[model samples]
Target: MNPFRYERALDVDHAVQAASQGGRFIAGGTNLLDLMKENVERPRRLVDISRLNLDRIEPLSDGGLRIGALARNADLAGHPQVLRQYPLLSSALMAGASPQLRNMATTGGNLMQRTRCYYFYDTATPCNKRSPGSGCGAVGGCTRIHAILGASEHCIAVHPSDMCVAMAALGATINVAGPQGRRTIPFEEFHRLPGDAPQYDNTLGEGELITGVDLPAEGFAGHYSYLKIRDRLSYAFALVSVAAALRLEDDGRIAEARVALGGVAHKPWRLPDAERMLAGETPGSRVFARFADALLEGATGQGDNEFKIELACRAIVRALEQAANGTPQSQVDKRIA
Candidate 1:
């Protein structure tokens, strides 16, 4: 790791002041530390906010949730309110890294995580996200895990976060504090697509600190699923993951729906077309197939990951089916050989 100065923040104001001078904010240090060790991220200073009083899970008056950014993944996943109300989020969190990692990973850090692209992590390789204006090595190189949607010629990397996928589907709001002041950002607008400027991941401003996320009151608890398909499953990054939520009327007709895809784009790819198609349709294989087709309408994969288009289609259908049947994974779903 590169030599860097560190300071423990006394509070949110202190954190903002300390980080306003181009220092990186360190909470759980799970992702940032790894990047620093790999020399992918070399911050001159780290403002430690883990000691700040930003670690609480409170219920909002409007039946929503106010999750502190410093809340650990394990605690957030296992929280009674989360498991009972936001099962989709719980499942997604549990499907992510191991227990030890979950214990150390913070919600804010997870939201600020970088892509798991091999080229981005390899200093020898040219990656636009890593080094601006550098040629993208994954464009024509090994792209089995690259994106299939919202990918620009400059970069084709995908965001790797199960929690963000569910949060995107839930329409959460991210609260941020900065040198200027505090503001809230819609979940959908938080992360940006990898356009020409692949170097920037999200829409966060300079010297901004993520304080927490606000989940709306209306949740898809009764019918929601977070299905992650991977190579070996346990602790592996997602090959294709689906976060599905459906609110079916008493007559078995869908009243509302939300679907988001991970491991396929720069951010959690929301399927608005598929969601519209599912609005009035009944839950069935035929309907699910149509939903999946709508999701893949504009998807074009690279050579090695061309198979992901079809795989994502099948995964979407399966995830929706499970969600409709109210059988989202409570634990990690693995196929034992």
Candidate 2:
């Protein structure tokens, strides 16, 4: 690892100020440390913000939840209120890294973690995301895990955070603090799609520090599920995953639905078209299939990974059905052997 100066932040203001000096903010140091060791990320200074008072989970007056940025992944996932209320979010977090990592990872850091694309991680390979104008290797190289939606000619890497997928489906908002001031960004707009600038993954400006995440308590207070389908049973990234929340009407019809996907896009993919098609529709295989078909329109998959399209669709259908029927456990299998 490269030699670097380390500083511990006394408070939020100090953390933001220290971070503004071209230093990378380190909370859990789960993702950043790994990259630094690999020589993928070389920052001159490291600002340790783990000591800051950003580790609270409070209930909002508007029936929502405010999750602090420094809150550990394990704490948030195992919190009584979160498990009892936002089961989808809890499930997504639990499905992610191991128990040790979950204990060290933070909510803010989880959202900011970079992609797992081999090309992007290996400094030897030319990747636009690592160095703009360097060209993309995953475009024609190993692309089975590449993105199908919101991809650009510059890059097609998938966002690797499972927590963000749940946040997108839950209509969460990001709270940020920077040199200018504080600002709130919708979760959908937090991460940007790879357009011309694949190097920039999020809307956060340089030197901006994420404060926390706000989840609006609207729909899905009752029924919700997060289903991740990967090659391995545990400790593996998803080939395709679905986060769904559904509410049924008195006549057993869908009243409202929020659906978002991961492992298929540059960001968490929300399907408004699918949501619309399922609204007021009965919960059945046919209705779910129709919604899935509408969502998969225009999806371009590589030759080796074309099966992801069908796998993603099936996962979405099963997640919606499980949520609508109040099934706490998913019946879908996760096998690639």
Candidate 3:
């Protein structure tokens, strides 16, 4: 890792001021530290925001919740309020790394974590995301774990956060603090597509520090599931994961739905068309399967991951079915493919 100056921020204002002056904000250090070791991120100065009193998860008056950016993943997942009111978020958080890593990973850090694409991590390889205009190695190399949606020829890397998948499905808002002022960005809009500039991951402006994330009142409480498919049962990045949340009428007709896919795109891939199709329709394999197909309409995989298109479709059905039946898989139970 490169030599860098470290400063502990006394407050949010301190952190923002330091960040605006050309310093990266460090919280959990789960992702940033690793990137630094790989030489992917070389910040000369780091402003520590972990002590900035932004770790609380507060209940909103409107029946929603505000999660501080410094809140740990384990606390967020195991909190009673989260399990009761936002189980989708809970399940998604628990589906991530092991207990030890979860204890150290923060909400904001997870959202800011870079993609796990092999080329991006290996400094020896030519990757556009790693060094813009260098050319993409994954485009013609091994791509089983790359993206199928929202990918350009320059990059095919997929976002690797399971928690953000649920957040996208829940329609959360990201709060950012910067020199200008504080601003809130919709969760879906925060993470950007890998367009011509594949290097930039999100819409966060330079020197903006994430404050917290706001979950809306309508979280689709009871009916939700986070299903992750990986090469192994645990400790592996998702091959294709699905976050499905549904609200059904008393007559078993779907009233509202939110579906997002992970490991398929540069950002959390939400299927608005599939959600629209599920509305007013009964939750069944037939309809879910058709909707899944519709959701994967423009999906095209690289050589090795061609099977992901089909795997994602089936995983979507399974996740939706589990959500509708109110039988979300326990965090400990890993489904082997």
lDDT (CA) for every model shown? 0.91, 0.87, 0.92
- Which segments of model 3 are wrong by more than 4 Å? none
lDDT of 2 by residue, 1-337 (tens): 9999999989878888888888889999999999998898899999999988999999999988999999999999888888877888888898898899999999999989899999989999999998999999898888889887778889989999989999999889999999899999999899999899999989998789999999887737577878888887778888898888988898989988888999999899996766888888888888988888887778888666778888888888888877877874442343311
Q: How would the candidate models be sorted by lDDT, starting from the highest?
A: 3, 1, 2
Please provide, for model 3 over 19-40, each residue's C-alpha lDDT reduced to its tens digit, 9 standing for 90 to 100: 8888998888988999999898
For candidate 1, the per-residue lDDT at 40 reads 96
TM-score for each model: 0.98, 0.96, 0.98
Question: Candidate 1: what lDDT?
Answer: 0.91
How badly does each model clash, as a count of residue pairs?
0, 0, 0
Better of 1 and 2 by lDDT: 1
- Evaluated at residue 140, the lDDT of candidate 3 is 81
The positional error of residue 1 in candidate 1, measured at the CA in angstroms, is 2.4
RMSD of 2: 2.1
Q: Sort the candidates on TM-score, descending order.
A: 3, 1, 2
